[model samples]
Target: MNAPTSPHILAAAQRPIPDAFMAALTARFGSQCVTSLAVREQHGRDEGSLTAPPPAAVVYAESTQDVQDAVALCHQHEVPVIAYGAGSSLEGHLLAVQGGISIDVNRMNQVLSIDTEDLTITVQPGITRKQLNEAIKDTGFFFPIDPGADASIGGMASTRASGTNAVRYGTMRENVLALEVVTASGQVIRTGNRAKKSAAGYDLTRLMVGSEGTLGIFTEISLRIYPLPEAVSAAICSFSTIEAAVRTVIETIQLGIPIARVELIDVNAVRMVNAYSKLDLREEPMLLMEFHGSPTGVKEQAEMVQDLASEHGGNAFEWAERPEDRTRLFTARHNAYFAAVASVPACRCITTDTCVPISRLADALLQCVTEADASGIPYFLVGHVGDGNFHFGYLIDPDNDTQRAQAEQLNHQLVQRAIALGGTCTGEHGIGVHKQGFLLEEAGEGAVAMMRAIKQALDPKNILNPGKIFQIG
Candidate 1:
């Protein structure tokens, strides 16, 4: 297989769009609406280490009406419309493959309403997870679909993102209750109600949750919130081997421990995190954990988990009770990707996520480590292991064809092993452009066909986030 070239290189150097098309876009959207050079380049890229393709124009949408009008215009012109959120997607979700319009929703960042009694908050599509949390901090409540980065709430819902808290609270699929979406035809429709469980009709709200913005543009969302935990305790436990650490997690979950967060970091990840965050953590495979509840309840849970870890050969456990200490610990954990990237000079990080059955986690992780070692690919491993989901970050020199090919081979083998263990190719990140082949292999022809039907039924014109989830003409 050939190395993946930079999308920008392909678009600008190999497949540049005609000037007449740019003139038509400007005529339709006006001068203030269209951005060409630097702005277009920036909007087309994302947190994913892959090279970005500049959208022909980047439009700053101000309201739902703006999105509707923009999509309507694109539909009429038979051009592709790619929705842009915080640019934090790891799977090339925002790259403008057809290169028409990058509809940026940043200006629409507004908390529409806060239903305190109902424990739900309604917000515009552009509102980020961190901004929402900060706005609702004083209310003693929070929306917890955290994807590490302060990603837009819409993007989180679109990608079905889950992070540290997913072990306890669940992912965006459980958090998002309703959505006001603009369809491909520029028609706005509400998906569900604020009421918890509805059996009235088809569950459209969920169908859109991990659609990767291929179905419609989410204009507003009503999300579930939870009261802040009464007590919170965080700790770190080191182990000699990654397998031992993962086995401890599996055992803890099997024993019905109500742990709020249990993340596994391989020895390599621990080293990179220490250097990146300037902390002197022991460079060994470790489990970073947290518990939430009454002080007594948290203590009991921690003790129970400590016993399980001991059985798995876990070393001394270090607990952090102070708020500042807990904050610093989790902050470093969240920055694991950046730390991994920083460890390698002039190399881009390619991350692959896979989830397996709890009993198979140890085997899966060990296999991943062995593959990386055998290939001599510099990599780091970290995961929400409590959910049996883990990620591998491979730092590769994309310019080197042999190195890039080897990395892809390793990634493919990892995905194959995960699927063989009855897990998914992507645990949280949706099947955007990068993992479409894996998705087809895992889900099979029938499932892929059903997904295509849904896409066609909702977006007949193929204008809503074209060339994502699965490739289209």
Candidate 2:
């Protein structure tokens, strides 16, 4: 059970939007300012189980000026403001919990400029990863961050999201080179230039990358792009047990093999993918891997992986060299979240993402799965184990109080274990609302106090994404 708060804690109160603010926004945005219930409700929730109440209104921002104007007005009224991208967040990052304004940036999707020579791309914040890749696929280059949701670049940066490719290309923190952000008072500021490296002041670019929209609104982003590999091959390997599969990942990473992608899915997850995506595979723990290099280089990597797998009781390595086969294999793996949730009818899934040190992964994972299994809650287990990161999508009936409690308890235990193992409360997923408490535990009083001080200094009015990350008076 959660500890009752101390008497000094102040309860969060939802403030009503003033009529003057609404009138001003509508006049400034014309038809783009939406206040209808249908639209407001759609912008309120994301893909997560927790849906905060809808915002009082939604402003479709088309450019930096639009966002600046809207934020300025909201700041003037001292109303809460939340930034909305694709609404693909797993945590309640985009919800307007304090009944203020939601500045939607999806309409701002546009690839502004591409610099092949510099190997960088500048875009409006709302462009999706797939869409960005599609626009530049013919250029022999692609963006490497794939959070599996077709999520917006702005949202990806907001949550600092990562996925299977992170083992090779790094997360948004490493790829996002610079940003154009609107401050709390609606002033526009650029963080950096196109330089590959900088010894500049403060590193504000890194600061906004994972701020979860509580710090500033991202109006534009510059990202590092990678050259497409000459040869890419994918394969699936079955293991005798989950522990064996995890051990194989440990060995592979320890050997310093520059693998492109390595993901783990337990037998139950494989079964769900087989049912939902309609593919026949062995009902056992599995590792889905991909290698990006020259033909001979990938072949050499495959041999090394095969040897490592065999040492751990793994069997039946199925390789996919053809483009269609590779796409199909990755598609199924990327859709693991949907497949898992679909396994149970009328259920809400809580995808608990925790990352431990590579050495402690197997131990931490065993404890998490054991506790989840013992709880009798239905779940699907998957992980990008190469980086010691994984998620278990706990399926629970939304309306059933007992199921929700059981699922929360299961998450609490798993997060506690991960923290004890010198891991984080979240890896790729940012510290959205759900893990606020865990953030306090993981970052401790000093670090959190420092963060709060910075936040207070920047957003003194406390109007930006209030009730998220941490609670402050």
Candidate 3:
């Protein structure tokens, strides 16, 4: 695999945003069109450490027409249009690498439709996961594709995100069924229908689902939602070693257990979360798991998992059966990134994620852990281990080049190992600015060439989030 690219590259390709375009945008959007440096700076960065000049301006788009107008203006001016949502992406997905205008869709938050009979909900792109769940709570359905953060459905779909529950309910690639997209030329088009399956033409919905806003900007998304489980139980089991915890997960999956979620939190992350979230979690390699089904089925699944954990030297399961207790537990798991960030003062996070086949997970994880331990870097480990996906957030002082290089080296090794073991460089995080080289190495020349060809065909002027996913030739 190619080495990790530096995120400090200057915006040498930044094109000027014409005054006429700004004037037109302000006329069309009124106060929604903001040139404030603070807003631009806010829209420019993401959770990871990558840096770039802020977009020339920001537009708070509240409707599909608003997005279309903004894109049309950008296309007319040949200015990059970066779609901004909740700003939760970790791989610099929101960075405006080339000078442009950011179309902030968070103001477009609304639920367009809910097909309770069909188990589908169509929502505006700006509605977050928590908001969606809340909106549908009375209807007894919840969106299952949670990427930890209360990310916007549009952003989640853009990244093809999967999280703790992905092992059971699948990712955005599976949950998202239809889309209302604003093309680079500011044309609104609908892809697919709310039907469960389709054999009609190209699978454009899937193509745009994880395009990271390169192909099109999502205005409306129709998602498959699931009924709240009949019974739910969450438990945490401490393991003597990370390997044992991973092995138990592998065995549980191999046995075809329908586990809803199984996440691994290393000792360091557990410590961080304990302090950051004010919880007294066991300071050992632990698996935070949940079982969903009928009461009997949940009980059976938990017992089987407990037995498997016993074989691997996992301590007794600490159960969180009440809804409030379960929420607290999962909230802590979701807050792990922040917890890790707080562990190091003013440190930039160089985070990386990789996934391998279930059988090779132990091999892939242990080697990387050893390398990380030897590197003497302050880092935290966490994973949705049931699906063989894990992340490392290496904390580095921004001024320390050596620490950054060491972190990058460790990231390189981990990605290479994951790819070599028949896995991917990024299991959920799309190839934004950070993983461009790795995507090329993983998908190879011909595949990425086709991706570029697709990008060129759909976005001829490349106004939609330029310089992301893969660099245009």
Best by TM-score: 3
> What digit string (tens of lDDT, one per residue) describes model 2 on residues 1-473?
37212121122467888999999999999999998999999998888877667889999999999999999998999999999988988877877767798999998999999999999999998999999999999999999998888999999998899999999999999999999999999999999789989998999999888999999999999999999999999999999889999999999999999899999999999999999999998889999999999999999998899899999999999999999998898899888889988999998898799999999999999988888888888898999899999999989888777777778778888888899999998998777677788899889989999999989999999898987888887
lDDT, residue 280, candidate 3: 89
Q: Return the TM-score for each candidate structure.
A: 0.95, 0.97, 0.99
Q: Write the per-residue lDDT of candidate 1 for residues 1-473, one digit (tens) a residue.
A: 23333232234221344566567656756754767588888888787756656777887888898888887777666677888889999887888776677899998999989988999999998989899999999999988666688899989999999988999999999999999998888889999999988998999999999999999999999999999999999999999988888889998999899999999988899999999999999899999999999999999999999998999899969999999999999999999999988898888877888999988998888877888999888999999999999999889886776777677778888989999999999999888777888888999989999999999888887777777888654
Could you give candidate 3's per-residue lDDT for residues 1-473 as a string of tens digits?
Answer: 45665845446478888889888989998999899999999999988788898998999999999999899999998999999999999888888888898999998889989999999999999999999999989998899987999899999999999999999999999999999999999999999999889999999998999999998999999999998999999999999999999999999999999999999999999999999999988899999999999999999999999999999999968999999999999999999999998999998888888999999999999999999999999999999999999999999998887788789989999998999999999999888888888998899999999999999999998888888888886
lDDT of model 2 at position 228:
98
Residue 24, candidate 1: alpha-carbon lDDT: 60
Return the TM-score for candidate 3, rounded to 2 decimals: 0.99
Candidate order by TM-score, decreasing, is 3, 2, 1
- Which residues of candidate 2, in runs, are more than 4 Å off? 1-12
Pairs in clash, predicted candidate 2: none
Model 3 poorest ten-residue lDDT run: 1-10
Candidates 1 and 2, the one with greater lDDT: 2
Distance from true position, residue 75, model 2, in Å? 0.6
lDDT value, candidate 3, whole model: 0.92
lDDT values, one for every candidate: 0.86, 0.89, 0.92
By TM-score, the better pick of 1 and 2 is 2
